[model samples]
Structure formats: structure tokens, C-alpha cells
Target: MNVVPDPITTQEQASKERENLLDFFARGLICTTARAVGADHGEPSEEALTKARAVADDYLAAYEEWLVKLTADNAAPGPQ
Candidate 1:
């Protein structure tokens, strides 16, 4: 006989999956920035550096926004 999964366990698993995906994307952003700055024999051009900085800043802002939303969501009350 097959058993049904618990709702709480399912929710927790989904939450973990979301966190893992976010972490993966964050690492991707870091790697992209590193590649942009470390290109051309360990000396990227000024324009490349500037563009990389902008990209990094945007990524940071997005991360902060996500954190705020996550914090708010966690602080909210759940079902009784």
C-alpha cells in the first residue's frame, strides 16, 4: 500500500528547495562578477570593471530585497 505525504513535510521540503535555488543563483552572480573582473590575464579593462561593479551592485540590491520579503513572510502568522 502507498502512503500519502504529510503537508507540513511537503511544505518544508519546498522551502528547502527554494532556499537551495536562491543560493545557486547567488553563487552564479558571484562567479559572473569574478569572471568579469579576472578576465584578460588577470587584468580586466576599466570598462569591463565598471560594468561588473554595476552588475554586482544590482545583484546585491536584489538579494537585499529578497531577504526583506523572506523576513516579512517568516514573521507573518501561520494557520492555528
Candidate 2:
């Protein structure tokens, strides 16, 4: 017999996938920033690394907000 996934389970799976994608993007952003910083100065200091992480966190937050707004706008019914 084939197993059927519940709606809630499907939503959960999608949420997990979105989180994973966000995390992957955030890490890549951090690494790229760190590499650029390191290239300029042999190695980045702890403070610099901390700042990079903070920036990444801020970026993710802003990105999430933008996505929410975009989704909401798209979901709204278009003018007749």
C-alpha cells in the first residue's frame, strides 16, 4: 500500500526545506564576506568575524520580511 502524506506533514516538510535553504544561503554569505575580508588582510579578526555573522543574521531577517510581503501581495486578489 502507498503511504499518503498529511497536509500538516507536507507543510512541515516544506518549512524544513525552506529553513535549510536559508541556512545554506546565510552560511555562503558569511563565508564569502569572510574570504573577502581575509583577502584584504591576511586573516579576519574575531571582531570582524563577529560583525560578519551579525550582518548575515540581519540579512536573513530582512530577506524573510521581504518574502512575507511579496507572498502576501501575490496572494491578494488582483483587481477585476
| Prediction 2 global C-alpha lDDT | 0.68
What's the distance in Å from true for residue 8, model 2?
A: 11
- Per-model TM values vs. the true structure: 0.46, 0.46
Q: What is the TM-score of candidate 1?
A: 0.46
lDDT winner = 2
Error of 1 at 59 (Å): 1.2
Clashes (N, CA, C under 3 Å) per candidate: 0, 0
Model 1, span 12-55: residue lDDT tens: 89677555555555555555668789843444556655555566
Clash pairs, model 2 backbone: none
lDDT at 40, model 2: 39
lDDT of each: 0.64, 0.68
